[model samples]
Target chain A: MKAFEFLDEIGTVNTHTMVLDKGLGYAYVEDALKITGEYFDLLKYGWGTSILYDTEIIKAKNELYHSYDIKTYTGGTLFELANKQNKLGEYFEELDNLGFDAVEVSDGSTVIDPDIRENAIKQAKENGFYTLSEIGKKNPEKDHAYTTEQRIELINKDISNGSDMVIIEGRESGKNIGIYDEKGNVKTDEMTQIHENTPNEKVLWEAPQKNQQVELILKLGNNVNLGNINSNEIISLETLRRGLRGDTLGKIQK
Target chain B: MKAFEFLDEIGTVNTHTMVLDKGLGYAYVEDALKITGEYFDLLKYGWGTSILYDTEIIKAKNELYHSYDIKTYTGGTLFELANKQNKLGEYFEELDNLGFDAVEVSDGSTVIDPDIRENAIKQAKENGFYTLSEIGKKNPEKDHAYTTEQRIELINKDISNGSDMVIIEGRESGKNIGIYDEKGNVKTDEMTQIHENTPNEKVLWEAPQKNQQVELILKLGNNVNLGNINSNEIISLETLRRGLRGDTLGKIQK
Candidate 1:
């Protein structure tokens, strides 16, 4: 039913695009979904943004995303903030009341005991919410201290602790953070090492830049789950995955 | 009514924020404008993106933007493309049918003789369109050859030729091209020289970066006409103009 559905039929496609929705208005959510809803599966109302909106608008935006079968969740920063306030229970209750079907557990911006991190993941699952846990410090210095081996071990542990997916931190800027260099280019050696060790299906890499997205797709095949995509680039990214764009055209094969 | 109208009573604010809309869905525009429309004065369909969408959708989007009292215009690259193809007449007619009230003239990606550039500006004005003529080549290598004095000369010529406003090229990246270094920092010497010489009222600076926006506001006052702002940053830019944000807070007076 897509405009160029035949083009995508030429290859085997494996894509689970997770778009970041940072305080979208309900009308935008309603209308934008008609064009891009089918291409994305997960929607994250970006860090601490939902907290700034009224309960009514947040609820309305969540309902609209859900109407498209796009599972909606609050950003990891919100969960961290809730934990810092010792209101994790209140957070879960409020998320359910607002019709969010998932929760992101991240310690990127804060510190929590390992036991607490594991328990939060388990608790979200117990509450019938899809739990996504993130690994990597928000600060570049702290994030860089972890070797590829350490990140790999954490990804496996999070999966065993009942997280449906584990996100690797690539903040909105995507520069000098995690596997990206200062110029927003991928560190291929680190990326390859992690790719070889981690469960690809359970990991979502936040590739916010176009060059990063292109490199990830070309290196990991078209099905690599990419997160933090800007809303406007949804269609353009779809083209890259299907070899319809100049960057990936005839270069990608099933 | 704004969210924090009570806070901005300290000073008079002069700002004309122009946002770049590269093919947004009509629904998103309708919903998003409600949240941030009051902060912006112009909406530009970025560089040839309007030619990619249906004529009806383009017209509808223009109407939606105009409803918020935001003047709508196509990117100058589209004008250059049409001029290259010898379709300037058809392009103007189409823009009229699509309800666009303004047109941009530029020689960014192609060669336009000075006479043609001036005529294009005058022709657009003659066709009942508000004209915005841009100075600076799209190619950084080519753009760097022009001295600041030459740029000032072009700006004066464009205005004299009936361009309602003249834009300085910062091209979405805001780096190493016009009054910016490779790191996207403003070159103060060149900027100061141009500011001192140019007609400030008729010039729009396409500043796509936050640092650039902050610097311009600090140097030229909050009322400076700034273009190419991301849609999400409209409210944030307004806050900067009114000295409400941390960057410019308490630094400016009415």
Candidate 2:
């Protein structure tokens, strides 16, 4: 039973939240899971940080997330690095050995041929992994080049190509990427276009900022899938989802 | 033995880092300490977050921090809240019972008479607490009203009134407050004036941004005291201090 349980009875719906675990220690993950394990649906080991720690630690964290029935995967950068090295086969094998149940396929930091990108998604799904494909470049200039129509088309194509979910690239900063403006505010017109075209359940917005989360939730309803959330903000985000926080309080519709 | 020890063989010095603990779990604190515990000198329960958690959990966290020889205190907002209720004496007693060995005396969110502010610092010290008094308003507009000269005078006075450390408030956002501009960049002239007039060891700057941390480390020679650091960035800040991160790698002064 949560504190303020009476106030949070409304707006409790099936929502997907993917938290970024950027090189947190094993004990810390365990501690956080005790409180907020049920709130988050996916756990992402952020951008090449997994390679910095011992393989044993990574494996342990994966197993821990799995215990809570949460899907876990390495960041897309690691996958991109493996693809660049022509070691996708080895990467899939290592991911399985490391206990990862999901894989993020992205070309944010690198370019991949469309055929190869679709193939990566198929291979990840074939290997019994939850495949998440991302749209948008990490560089602001590169990301801004993609129109909303282009983003929506890619999101739909990835969903058709066997990605369990398509993640809009907000990066860790959540600034000037995908559907967000330079100040980290949501480009509502762009967002609505993507939402109207894509399957709502299959598209996860990588909203790392509070305003982004609130805006996404209010615009798309409480069940809007949000990703790239900082690990510390898990409980806080859950409150926002349930309209317990001031931002979404009395504003969330069932 | 830290990983990448070879790359971090330079710029080691005695420094004070106060991390903001905005309600972390027990195992999480233990896990963080296992990795970067020795790096931080103080742990502040951010704002009124402490009052929101159960007293037992707060006490346990305080004890946990103490075990690592890191002094723990509630944020200045809590101190001000207590002061508003005329419960300063009770606040000190409760702090002792909760295992906190430090207290922050400040009027960031409320007004405090000059004599009362001095008395609060003296009372905290008399209670054998490591007293920290802040020198900025929580509101950006009000904070900007303080001239560098006024800030310097207050800081010097706080130290004389028995504050173990005088903090220059940068808030959690670290923008448009104290020495930071709207873009969160350091106001070099204002920073220099404060640095020149105050006793460096007795002053702690609240710099929650990476750029602010890097700038302070480079300008103040790695030993400059920093506060309001995000708990997740403890290791990252340690890396910056030791010239391990790209931002400060070749720039840190001995």
Candidate 3:
């Protein structure tokens, strides 16, 4: 029952869009999902925000997302916090009890031994949860230390370690970080190199900016996996992927 | 009944927070209002977006906002569109019929003679609608043509011509336009000069960025009228006003 059905040019591309849910009210999410849910693939309760909200609300939100067939996971920061506390087992248990069907394993905010990172990924899979592992430091200085080759190695390692998908670190602000420059423009050479060498289909780029989303979609086709999209921009991003927006209009191939 | 009332140091300062609504679903508005309606002073259907949705939806949204005692109006772009089409009277009647009790009289996207601008403000008042006149151009090049004195003159004239409040243009992005620089930093000297000359209470600054919001709150007190705030940032802005967030914590006087 979508409006302008005749103009639905995006077609079935099997694109993955992971929306960032940073502490939104359940009713708001419910209503928003009604408008843009079918386009959504995954939902991340943004970094450490899951711990802030009432447990009942988180459970309700997880169930709501599940009803829409969107996989729900706590942000990587919570996992890092739990690892810091040496309560990884309890963290996994907490996620299950809260009805989250997915977990993101990331050492962005804190350090985790390579074995622990791999084990956590495997544990999440064993625990009947879809695992998304991220590879990048939250600190820009540390993030910059990894060469394109190093990033590729980490992405591959995570996938081999049983991650269903590995995410590239773009953070919420897609500026001067990872494959983006100071003005949030993509570093095309590095992007090309990474795409060529990595398991491209399993890699989700955290493109929080509109330009980044447009660039990625145009370069890699509309089926490109885009993550960290703001809740408000969900419908807008779908339009971009479909060439309905002016930015991507007449550019996306049906 | 608010959470952590003991931590609320803001002490109920009189403030006006105008949120930009770009075609939100009714259920989303209902849910959002439960969390933030009390904090909202006005809801603007951003930049001719009212024309895109069905009239029934617009009327429903206006009613929903009015239920929370929040005034609802279409964006200035709609006014400019009406002026361009020479449908001012029809536009005013349509707004009333559509259940919008307020109208924004602005020349952001198009030029209006001083007499016409003033007449529009007065006409809106005569029609029994709350009138808010905006005093900046939407295009940066055109906006830059107005000097501080010229801008101040417009503000004074708009108020004298019967504008309930005059909004300074910050156009969604709050960057390199008006009082903001290319980096979205506030131009302190220009801002100081404008504030000193204007009828401050009747002026609502459209500060969409976090830094701008923080800087304005710190300099002009938490009670300063702020417009063009994104819908999602309503509660966050309220927190900043009340000194609840880290940026404004210990900054605002109790």
Q: List where candidate 1 sits over 4 angstroms from the true fold.
A: A1-28, A35-179, A187-206, A210-227, A232-254, B1-15, B22-38, B51-57, B242-254
**TM-scores, in order shown?**
0.62, 0.61, 0.61
Q: In candidate 1 chain A, where is summed lDDT lowest over 10 consecutive residues? A: A1-10
Clashing pairs in 1: A14-A223, B14-B223
Write down the lDDT of every candidate, Cα atoms only. Answer: 0.83, 0.86, 0.85
Model 1 per-residue lDDT at A37: 71
Give residue A192's lDDT in candidate 1 (0 to 100): 93
DockQ of each: 0.10, 0.09, 0.08
Return the clash pairs for model 3, or none: none
TM-score of chain A of 3: 0.97
Our tally of clashes for model 1 stands at: 2
